[model samples]
Target: METVDEVDAPQVRQCPECGATVSVHARFVSWCAACDWNVDPGAPDPDRGRLAAYRKRLARRYGQQLAEEIERSGQEARRVGPDGSTVLAFGVSLLVHSVSGGLLLAAGLLIIGGWHTRILPVFGIVLLIAVATLLPRPGRLPKGAPVLYRADAPRLFELIDEVGAAVGTTGVHAVALDTAHNAWVSTYGIRNRRVMCLGAGLWEVLSPQERVALLGHELGHFANGDVRSSFVMHGALRTLARWYYFLVPHPLDSLLDLCVNTLVFLPRWAVYGLIVLLDGLTLRASQRAEYLADAGAARAGSTVAAVTLMDRLLIGDAVEAHLRRASMTAPEASGGSRGREAREAAERELWERLAARIGSVPESEYERLRRVSARRGHSVDDTHPPTHLRRRCLASAGPHPARVVCDASRTRSIAAELAPARARLARTVIRYNAD
Candidate 1:
């Protein structure tokens, strides 16, 4: 069978905007090479929504500032320390937790004093509920989440550990796999055990060195001194968000309900304002931490590998769309003994098909994606700075040799270890699309 990158013929077309001749590929965007028309076709404007507009402003203001700073200082930009913004973030966090504690104390006192007055207990119960709603809860992994322990995937764990060491942090306790096209590291449960979550969609497309870059970036979070990720601040942010959720008025059915909602309106907006304020205070520091983490990526996987990883991320939308198309078009088996065998065969082939599809993307397509991203100021999400800025920063940094190298033999071993997860996630994608 012909691969995705193989085109029998190039279709010539005129650019609607510039009247320039363009060469169109079968599976890639066609644009006028001279005029650069349609280079970012159909991409939504990054400055669309209110929150998005705010984030875009932040990205421009801080992203440019940090990029310039990095250009001037080089590796010195990686050293982040307590500043006014971070201190304010911590202060707000303290205030939020204190409010929660006060509510708990008041509820306990009222409940204990209920022996003297029946109404006191009723009010205490209400206060207790409010306290529960306001309290910061530990993060929990979703039920039946696919988790890989060190024992089960020694080679993979070793790679992660080496990356972690390079990034100046201890390795994560566990690895979690999911179906999204992203990767992150978060502390889970009351003990705050660090777990690295890898999305199968993203993982399958990365080269071994890029995978090390990805790991270095994530593990760097623990060492990068992101104030927002600190326990106190993270909990406070969650608590305020929860408060806003509960305080928001529901649909009213009666006059009493209207009155109750009216009373809540101010508090709801107040919590929202606080959330915004806290986010603003920590925004700069967080963006800086991300850049520091990117430096870690370069340190662990070499500058070239890290920069290539960023380039790959620029085409994430294309990758996801390809996967979606594959999922939707996967053949369904007819009911019978033969059907089960056919289904299993298709499941087993899913990863291979996806790998081939992604691997077949040409260098020109990647270059186009980077140009589009630069134009769009694209990012993985609002939390991240623009991809163009990140790419520029990575390129500007001096090249460093890779600290953790995964040879072909170890890479194959790691692949073998992940085979079961690959199979399970492949079936999941197929079943989801079928439904």
Candidate 2:
């Protein structure tokens, strides 16, 4: 038996049954030249078949489990684990539950009272600030920036247009390959309403079928309001943080700071315990939201493709996460960073030399910079969680909540259903604020 990655050419050996030359590479077993003895190739074929079946069975089971976990959590804001234990994120912040009407009323009264008393202009200024906060945040992409949907190849502009149409949400304004192995849409432009291809690395590794699932996953975000909810949360966070900062006056800032430092700098064990409690609770709802997004993808495209993409995303995510974690310890990635550029250059050279040795990369004088990229990314404290953690959110998933009977017509049907909603929302949002 030979591996696809390792084997070079057909192996020739004397037949065990007779002193005759026999050639074997894949499952095929040719007739021995001397003895003319033919062997059944079905043996290897069945074993391969069995292995394929087993892999598929396991993949589906894992997918189902992960899906179940997500659906359970998404609907209830609880992390329902294998043992049936339910944990939660820190108690829902007042932001999640605050009634807009109440907040507006309070804001209105504050403004009027300030004017009535002829007080400082702070209250009216605050109300105006609050209104501004309500606007949706957009992703960060310039207009029609070229996106390398995948390394070595770019998804056509028309395909992106088609996908945006299917989602019936904001169309992709710019495509950028994310450094991570997974794919996502980042809000770009004004208030982050524009979508950016957040998965350049992912597109690099995934097959076309798997990429469709990845696309569908983004579509899930569109369908499930994940994007909208994220912006809403951002506004809420901004609003609360503003209030907290506002309340901490110059006089009290010192005392408040002291208390925060003391609590945070407590015994290592104590701090860790507190963080775990908060994190565990927060993960519950966050995990659940992930499932709804998964379900959204399944409903949007072929389920089989979705599953396939997830599997690739899982395995590849491991490598990406390793690089990401390493980045945390890695020196800062800048021209000033010591040896960072040199180290990356060295790695790139090694891979390129190997690729050239294997004919994987084209030959050119400038081929050295051909597809130049650092496998390691900067560890910026961004909204996205760690790569491995994000991967588990999908890789360890269970069955899709709704089974998709994928067919030629399925794409059109899904697109049609989403188009009207996307158009209406686009128009309304264009008129209204993004958030």
Candidate 3:
């Protein structure tokens, strides 16, 4: 179909279906009302098959490139940093802390020794103040305190272990299930043990094959050593940030804070600037790590299944948002067994509604979403590359083919085991908001 150059003529467009000059909306021109022709000739909407094939190719290429980059990073760390980049970062941090601490100690000792006679009381008070201000406060722990639940699902654990083995990583040591529509593999404890967190909502939407793909992707992070490297960088950066924030005095909350803030501001700012510089330097590598993980997922399952899992996530997120908005308008929960049952029923209804919404989305709509997500690209704050990019990377996944970890019946059984917790969590949301 022919299209219109409405960017230059926003107010009017000649419809392709009918030769009528239809009035345009002046925004993202949806369609001509006169003949219902699509007026906004945006991106080139390629045919579905070609687009899918292109995506697969991109995924494969990205995955290969990522593997190479990760290998190089490991080699580079060994060559340049000796003990590794993370260790070097920590060593530098320790040196900085020690120097600052020593200086503070020296200052206190000199003040007390010099003012031992007449000005001792006043000097002691002054010294105490100096010590308090100069001392670096403990760094704040990472926020977004994850709601961790026991990953007591035996079948789920076995699946994770199998995926980990396939991906060539020391398998996940701990598992947590949370409410969000996401999944990740991370480290915890002094030993830096691996923990995999699965979003219960995400699990509900994924098929058995999709679940394997998802697990593979998470486990892949460990295989690529993304978690371990990031940990060191984060620790160093957090230490600097903590010192910066802590230096700003609190009692007055304004004027005193401002004065202290000024005194420590320049050094703190330098540290922050350094963190930003480091992030900028490492951003591309981090993104590559994500692509490699997706490749790993494609290996565990089929490329199509991996991509489908990502596609469903876009719709699943929308579903969650819709359910939340609906819950806000729900009637207040009465404190009784009957009311509790009613609220629980409403929660269940919302979940069904969510699943239905996801199922109802057209293939064309999904394609459109892929286009938009790809176009948006990755932001500075984003650790993973954009979904479209990841999809493209997986397209080239030839080495990793589909491997079934669980049958349909086993998946259903696993779902049943976790169903009670998810249900309770859903009902809790409804009840909590009712008040």
Candidate 4:
């Protein structure tokens, strides 16, 4: 099946060997995941036009107004929490904590029984309160808030099958691509189907190969089930984790947590402090995921192509500048200008880091290309890592790519490519966390 990964290949909907949903992800793809019948994109829906095809690759479903609506709707959706998943989780966390607390309470009683050893009572009481306070509670995302998805581009649907087959994956449920040159896969709707977002910004900037590389990385997310798993994980944890990202990253986040819990009178701006913490974590994850996705991208599009895409992302600071402008354009009247400003600043910051990590192209070549993408109107942010670190991982990566081509999803496939390497990578990640 031709998948979302192979952009250069022709889009066909019919199978020559059998009449099935022509697998678009791979050539000679014969089966359809949705309906067992084979279908092909090449067979061409008589209604689709060459012009529509071209524009579809570049335009959005609705203008900015529609996007804002979708953004609005999505926020409400994230908060639904599915019949008290949050409440259930909070209950579970409480139960877990209560049991431990009960044990401590008993210890405290025992200590008090032997008041001669006052140290045990003091320690038990203190630990008991601490665990009880840390217990999870039902958290809410304001009564009404929306989580936004990437722009839905018109042409992104073209890559769905191509990307799927290239990675041996299947099914992109929702079509979304914007007029901008960026393309990404997101999920929305209760159905939990794939929502593809393509920006004119992305189409204008990335080379076809680079686009294919990204598609493969996204499909890796999908075919690998990273997308849905992320959704579920986030859904379950959102309430419990309201204060989590704040506790984790950086030495100071823990301090921030102490102030919030102990003082009991946290200033609103403590949110700003958490933002600072999350900013750092996001930057780190972006850099890390870049290497992983790049590894997958390489398998999707030769190693050389993957490296080149990193170079392209780095050289393309104009993208950052554009996103900065777009963000700035959001009505200042919106509830949170400072938050917007922070996000814009963060994007620029990430784009800059991307340059430092992915360094190999001559400065002169890099500058020239960055300028060119700037001219075309594709905007990128600093979220990507430096190319050098990424390239190094790939260069030193196992000679044989993982058999499953970076499968993070639950697909039955050949033995995972480079099991030892995968295990090492997982351990490396764990140790990094241990730090």
Using lDDT, give the best candidate's number.
1
lDDT of 1 by residue, 105-141 (tens): 9999999977489899889999999889778777776
| Tens-digit per-residue lDDT, 1-435, candidate 2 | 644334534567777778766665432335454544553222221223432343333333433454455445553112233222221221223333254446566667777766667553467667657755643355456333334332222234344444444544444554553344555666655655545464434554544445555665675556545421455544444444444334332333687777655554544334334333333333333434455555445434444555545444424423444344433433333544445565454433332232222232112111211111011111111222222333334444444432323344544543343333333322221222122
Q: Could you give candidate 3's per-residue lDDT for residues 1-435 as a string of tens digits?
A: 423333323465676788878654432333554554653345533434532333333444443455455445532111122235444445655655565567566666666676656565566566567556544443222243333233556776677778878777757666666666787766666667677777756766677788889988888778875522565555554555555566544565688677866777777667656545444444445556666677678777667788888786655546577657656755566668876777767776755565554555545456645655554442112355556655654554344467646787777777766666666656644644434
Q: What would the TM-scores of all predictions be?
A: 0.92, 0.40, 0.67, 0.37
Model 3, residue 284: displacement in angstroms? 3.2
Residues forming the 10-long window of minimal summed lDDT in candidate 2:
370-379
Q: What is the lDDT of residue 52 in candidate 2?
A: 33
Q: lDDT of all predictions, in order shown?
A: 0.83, 0.42, 0.59, 0.42
Q: Which stretches of candidate 1 lie above 4 Å from their native place?
A: 7-9, 14-21, 43-53, 74-76, 252-254, 432-435
**1 or 4: which has the higher lDDT?**
1
Model 2 lDDT at residue 213: 56
Model 4 clash tally, residue pairs? 82
Rank list by lDDT:
1, 3, 4, 2
